[model samples]
Target: MRKLQQRLDKIKDNNQAADALAGRRSEVKPESASPVAPERSRGRRRGWLIVLGMVVFGFVFGELALTVQGWSGPDFSDARRVGKATVVSCERRGPIGWGIGYWDQCTADVVWDGGFSGRYAIDRRNFFHADEVGTTVTIGEGAGSRGGGVVFSRPELPHRPAVVALGWGLAVIASIPILLLLGGTFVAARDAIRGVSKR
Candidate 1:
């Protein structure tokens, strides 16, 4: 009887061990056997998202660069009569960048032939002629045939090449960050989609 009982206990122990092994195998089968391909696919998809983001960033940078480059110009307005004289000046009311400058026109009545005459005058004593392009005009204290030359105003032909170049450079630099963000978002979205599909 003792031997038989011992044999029964051994059989029970063997059954329990077998059951534990079976449970472990079942748990591992679904987790470790499959889904490797899906994981790899997800990684590749993430990489593609990064690439797409880079392209978008490049486009944005290029656009910004073009916009900045287009801003290199003198703000000018058509000739208009202020008081009694016609004046034409560059109307720049904002900050001037490296390659930008402001020009203004101020005019007043002048005595000509003992009669009031309308004349056009630039903001400063510097007489800016249409023919004088790419030239700097310095306005100083002086009165001319027109009314008092526009008080203290000057025209400067700033170095535009550097400004344009810098703008382009900055645009290019900004593209990198934009690309990174876009790529990250795309990859994340793609992964999410894939996960949903798998589910």
Candidate 2:
């Protein structure tokens, strides 16, 4: 009976020691259940900050693309041409006009007399004389020598709506990344704030 009593006493002492150790551990750190919450919130905030930085970079890139694609200013002054007659060798005249076959059209200021001057289109088709003013100049569009002169007519260029549309499309596409980044940042910030508030 004495031996049985001693065994029971030993068991009780062991259980008491285990309970005391558990109590000490609990008191040492009371917030062990949710220690990772603040860390997760901070990580989310950092992610949002990174996204905002990326958005700013995307906006700058988009602006640069727009500036590059837009027209800077009007065409140069050499685009205008004025002279007395084709026989006078207007090619030697200062600031006469952009040369023939150039992309831009040249307008000739033909001076017949001291006071008689008229504007004419100088292109591959029509060579204007002083007397040709006020007369209808017909430009040919067919092949061969018959059609290869600049008549008094406006030059036609290919339609460029497709190019304009393509430029706009590219600009919008480049902006999409910025938009998404902003949205993601907003969502992350909101979530982080809510998490902090809940804590």
Candidate 3:
């Protein structure tokens, strides 16, 4: 009888321990789940933020590079100026590389009809979306136009430095958000790891 009683007591003790364990697990599971849902939400938002940042970075960087190059393209200031040419044809074509949107290459009528027959070419961005077919385009005799430090993009504005300070300005503006995103990601990850460890 004593042996049987001892066996019953042992069984009772085991049951109590199991119940306690189940209780603890049930309590912990809810708390862990709550935190996890929020973390996953944050992770999703951060992923999208990173994607958007990359797109913006690529666009701004390309424009910045193109603008700078436009400002510094071959100098035609010393051009042998075969003669002034009137824009005969203007066609919009996709950018070959590092170019932003629409680009136009114009074939100008070099004053060959009057003297020597020849053709000249000049290209510019379609900023105002204006028709330049009738516009007079300067044909460079040699290769570049370097007399002026900047080409007057705007007839009214006069001179614009190659890679206008604006490009740097946009880059600086774009960087602030990206830097914040990176720092936020790092901090969030650290905090998340720390939080998990505590659990």
lDDT of 3 by residue, 101-190 (tens): 566676666663247755545565542223767776444444324444322133322235545665566566656666777787899999
Model 2, 42-95: lDDT tens per residue? 999998787777776666556544443332211222223322433222232212
lDDT against the true structure, each candidate = 0.52, 0.49, 0.60
Assess every candidate by TM-score.
Answer: 0.33, 0.39, 0.49
lDDT value for model 3: 0.60
- Residue 186 lDDT in candidate 1: 95
Give candidate 3 regions above 4 Å deviation.
1-11, 23-38, 68-73, 89-105, 112-116, 119-121, 126-138, 144-199
Q: How far is candidate 1 from the true structure (C-alpha RMSD, Å)?
A: 13.4
**lDDT of each residue in 79-193, candidate 1, tens digit only:** 1221222233333321243223333334433323334454445433123433343333333222322653333222332225666787779686857777677677899899999
lDDT winner:
3
Using lDDT, rank the candidates from best to worst.
Answer: 3, 1, 2
Candidate order by TM-score, decreasing, is 3, 2, 1
lDDT of residue 155 for candidate 3: 31
Measured by TM-score, how close is model 3 to the native structure? 0.49
Worst lDDT 10-window in candidate 3: 149-158
